[model samples]
Target: MRRSIGETVILRYWNEGFEVQLKCQVEYIDNRTQMVIVSKQAEVLNIEFRNIYETL
Candidate 1:
């Protein structure tokens, strides 16, 4: 499944050996790098597109 900027998604990733999930909105996408920028609350994160577990 392809995701686009401005879409709401669930980002799942590993942190401190534990799985963490965050609800964020896609802020930007770098197709060349296959990286995505998402924002949750006041935080912004740079993540791989594949790390986006689900769309909401």
Candidate 2:
């Protein structure tokens, strides 16, 4: 599926050797780099496309 900025999504990624799920809003997407920037509350995160397990 195609995702855009300002969309809310659920992402599952490996963090500290653990699989964690984060619910955040999309801030930026770089298709060429396959990276996404999302914000959850006051925290901003950078995630890889491959690590995004789902969208909501």
Candidate 3:
């Protein structure tokens, strides 16, 4: 799978914080499987859903 900037990553907002999906937005391409995801609208950044790269 290939993920690029402006691409929406489907993630599940989790608890704890940064553990699972945070319903975050693609902030920037850090590398390949590593990216900066921001919190979803109306929700605070707590956990990360899943850092998965989309199929390109």
Most accurate candidate by TM-score: 2
Alpha-carbon runs more than 4 Å astray in model 2: none
Assess each prediction's global lDDT (C-alpha) against the native.
Answer: 0.74, 0.79, 0.43
For candidate 2, the 10 contiguous residues with the lowest summed lDDT are 1-10
Give the true-structure RMSD of model 1. 2.5
For model 3, give the 10-residue run with minimal summed lDDT.
Answer: 47-56
Q: What tens digits encode model 1's per-residue C-alpha lDDT throughout 1-56?
A: 24557878777765556677888888988889988778988999887766555555
Estimate candidate 2's alpha-carbon lDDT, on a 0 to 1 scale.
0.79
lDDT tens digits, residues 1-56, model 3? Answer: 12534555555443444434333455554445454444467553322225432322
What tens-digit string does per-residue lDDT give for candidate 2 at 1-56? 35457878777787667788887888988889998888999998888888766675
Error of 1 at 49 (Å): 2.2
lDDT of 3 at 48: 25
Q: How do all models score by TM-score? A: 0.63, 0.72, 0.32
